[model samples]
Target: MNKLNIDSLNFYFSKSTDVNDICVKLKSFQKKSHQLYKAHKHREAKQIALAYLELTDSLITKNNDDNCLLENRILFLNRLCELEKNHENYDKAYHYLIQIEKTINDKPVKDKINFQHQLQNSLNKAVIKNHLNMPQKAIEIAKETFKENISSIYYDKNSIESLSLEADITKTLADSYILLGKELNNASYLDSAFYFYHKSYDAAKIYDSSAKSAAFKHNIAMTDVLMARKDYKGAINSINNYKNTANSFDYKHHEYMNKAICYHALKNSDSAMYFAKKLIHNKKDKCRRSNLITLYNILSKEYFNLNEIDSAYKYSKLEITSFEKARKNKEKTFQLLYNNDFAEAKKLNSQIIKQENVNDKNKLIYIFSIIIILLLTYLYLVSKKKETNQIILDLKNNNVVEKTEKVAYNINEDFEAEILTAINLMEQQDAYLQADFSINKIAEKLETNSTYISFVFNKHKQETFKQYFTKKKISYIIDKLNTDTTYRKYSIQALAEEIGYGSSSAFTRAFKKQMNVTPSAYIKSLSK
Candidate 1:
C-alpha cells in the first residue's frame, strides 16, 4: 500500500471545502426571495423567494453533519413550495424535499422521520402532470403558493414535533399549487400558465426545489409568444431568453405558429400557410398535436377561400383524422356524437317534435343509432385489420420474415434473449444507468447496427431502445442531480448529448415528450 498521511488528506479536503461558498449562496437566495416578493409577478416572485429559502443548507456542508439543519431544511423547502402555490410548474417546487428525504435517511436520525413523508407528499403534489396533461391547472397552483411562501415571515413552530407537522401541511399546500399549474399549461392557457410557472420558479429559487426562477422566465417568455397571442413581442422576448437556454428550434416553432396565426388573422393566406406548414413539418417532438390540428383546420379554410378545392379537401381530411385521433381516440370512443355531432344533436331535437308518434320516433332513432354503431364498429375493425397488415408490410419491406403471422411474436434474430442479457450486464454495473448506451456499443461488445440489437432488446424488453434508454437516463439524472454538486458542470444541452441525442434541442424536445418537464426544471431539482 502507498504511504498515506493525515496532512495530505486534510489538504485535499480543504481544497474541495464548499461550506463558505454555500453560505454565501444561501444568503443570496434569501435576499432574492424577499426582493421578488415585492414584484408580485406571483410566480416569478415565489421562485426568487425559494431561491433564498433553500440557502439553509449552507450550515450543513463538508461532513460537519449537524442534525439541526434538517428541520430548517424542511422549513425552507416547504416554505419555497408554499410561496409557489400551483403556478403551473409548482410540482417541481417539492422536488427538493425528495433530496431532503434521502439526506435525512443518511443522517440516521429518527427525529427527521416525519419530514421524509412530508417531502414525498410535497413531491406528489408538485410533480409535473404527465397522466393528466393539465398545464393550465399547474399554473394556478404555483401562483398561489408563491405568495404564501413570500408573505409568511414569522413561523411559531419551535419543537421538532410541531416543525414536522407544519412541514407536512406546508408541503401539501405547495404541491397542490404545482399540480394545478401543470394542468393549466396543458390546457393551452399559456399566459396564465406561465404566470403560475413563475410562482413555482420564485419559490423553488428561494429553496432547494427542482423548480427554478430562470427556467420559469424562459418558459414564460417562450409561451407568451406562442400562447398569449402577443406574437411580435413574444417572439422578440423569447429569442433573448432562449438564446442561452435549451430548445431553440422547438421554442422557435411556437413563435412561428403564433406568427402563422397572426398572418391568418391579417388575411395573408400565403404567409399563414407558410408558418402553418413549418409547424406541421417540424422535426421537434415538442410540436403540440393540438397546435398542428388547429393549423391544419385553418389552412383548409384558407385553401377553401382561394378555391383550391383539392388542397382544401386534403387538409380538411387531415383535420378530421386529427380530431378522430385526439378526441375520439382513433374512434375507440365510437360515440355517434364524435362521428357526427351536429347530426346527433338534430336527431335528439327532432325526437321531441315527433313525440305524438312515439313508436315511429323510437324506431327511427333506434335504426339511426344502430346504423351509426355498426358503421363505427366496422371502421374500428377495418382499422385494426389495417394495423395488422401494416406490421406484415413492414416485415416484408425489411425482408426479415417470409410469411405474415398477424398474431405471432416479433421473433427474429432481433428479439432474442441473449441480446438483452448483454445490455442488462452493462446497466447493472453502473451506479446509475446511462441512457447513451447504444445498440452499436452493445453489439460491439458482443462483436455483432445497434438496430438489430435494439430490436432484440425491445422485443425481449417490450420497449423501444429509445424509450428504455431515455427512461434510464431520466431516472439516473433525477436522482444524481439532486445532491451531487459535481454535476453542475453539465449544461442542459450536455444532458441530452450525454444521453445519445444528436443535439440539445432534440434531447429537450424528446425529454419533454417522454418526461413532460423541461431540461432546465429537471436540472433545478438537482441543486434544489
Candidate 2:
C-alpha cells in the first residue's frame, strides 16, 4: 500500500468509457485509489467510486450477495461519503453513510472481526451530521461512539493507524465544538475547540505519516479560529509556533498564506506582500483556487496602496481571472449535487456519454481558438515592444520634438538658461533620488509655478517632467551599477531603495526603456 503510485493509474483510465473496463482498471489499482482519496484528490476518487458502483450493479445479479462484492460496495460508499462531505454536499454524504449502515446491518459482522469498519461507519455518520449544521447531534453520536469504543484507549498509541483513528475522533469533536461556537456566537465554546484540536495534534504527532499531516492541518485550523476572532497577532503567533512542523509536512505554503491574511487584516501591507509573494512564487496547479484568488487580491490592493499602478493592474487581472474560474468550478459542483442522489449522477454520466462527440468537437474548436488568440497576442506584444523601443531611441537621440502650439509665455533666452542651470544643479546633486520628487516639489524649490517648470522641460528638454526625471534617475543608477561593485551585488529591491525608484518593477521598466535592456541584463553585460 505504501509503495502504490495512484498517479500512474490516470494513464490507464484516461479514455475509459465502459464500466467493465473501468472496474478492471480500478480493481488492479484499489490500493492506489485509496491513497489518492486520502490525499484529497476528490475528482479522481469520485470517478473510481462511481465506476466501482456501476461494476457492482452489473455483477451483483450473478454473484448473489457475495461478501467480497458487498465489502467492495461498502468501501466505495465510504469514499463517496468523504468526497461528498468535502464538497459540502452534506445531504449526499448522509445518503452514502445511510447506505453504508444498511450494508453493515445486512452483513451482521462480529465486532472482534470488524471493529475498525464499524468505528469508521460511526465516525462518518457523526462527521456528516456536523457538516449538516447539527453540532449537538454530531457531538451526541461522537460521544456514543467513544463510549462504545472505550477499549481503543488501550490500543498502542505508537502505531500510526491507531493514532490516526484517535486523531480523527478528536478532530471531529473539535470541529463540532467550533461549529457550535459559531452558531451560538459563544466565545467559551472556542476554548473547547482548541482543547480538542490540540489533543488531535498530539495524537497525530505520534506518527510521521498521514497522521502528522492531519496535525499540521489541525494546527492551522486553530490559527483560523484565532483569525475569526479578530486576533491577528494571535494567529501570527500560532503560525510561528507551528512553522517548523509545517515545513516538515510541505505546509509552508499554507503557513505563508495564512500569515499574509493575518498581516493584511492588521494593515501591515508590506509584511503581507512579503508572505503573499512567498506563496505565489511556489504556487502549483494543485493549489486551491480560493487561496490563489485571495493572494492575488492582496497583492493588487497592496500595490495599489503603494501607488504602483502597473503592478496593481497586473495582480488585479490575475485576481479576476482566478475568481471567475473558481466561481465556474463551484457552479459545476453545485449542479452535480442539485439532485443529491447516486441515480442522478448515473443519469448525468449517461447524458455525458450521449454528448461526448459534441463535446470533443467543441474541445477541438476551443483549442484552435486558443492557439489563434495566443498567436495574435504574441504579435501584438511584439509590435508594442518595437514601438516602445523606437520611442526610447528617439528620446536618447534627441529627435523628440514638442508639437508646435501658440503660447502667451514668451520664452526669453535668459529665462531658459536659468531654468536649464537649475535643472543641471539638481541633477548633479542627485535630487531625483527621492520617492516623492515631482514637478510641484521642484517648482517650490525653484521659486516658480509648476506650469512654468513643465513649460521649461517640454520646451527646452523636449520631454515631460516625468520623462526627464525618470531618465536622470535611471542614468544615475546605471552609472552606479557599472562602477560600484557593491551596488551591482544588491538585489532589485535593494537597488530600487538606494536609487529611490518607489519599487523594483518601476525601476526595471524605466531602465529597459532608457537603456534598451533590463537592469539585470545590463549588469550581466557589464560582467561579460
lDDT per residue (tens digit) for residues 402-490 in model 1: 68543334544543666767777777864123334566777787776565676576656798776776777766656656667645545
Tens-digit per-residue lDDT, 342-382, candidate 2: 23333433443445455567869999999999999999989
Q: Which candidate is the best by lDDT?
A: 2
Off by over 4 Å in 1: 1-241, 244-250, 284-286, 328-528
**Residue 78 of model 1, lDDT score:** 52
Query: lDDT values of the candidates?
Result: 0.52, 0.71
For model 2, which pairs clash? none
Candidate 2 differs from the real structure by a C-alpha RMSD in angstroms, to one decimal, of 19.7
Any runs in candidate 2 off by more than 4 Å, and if so which?
1-28, 37-46, 84-95, 108-115, 128-137, 151-163, 182-185, 206-218, 225-230, 241-243, 246-248, 273-528
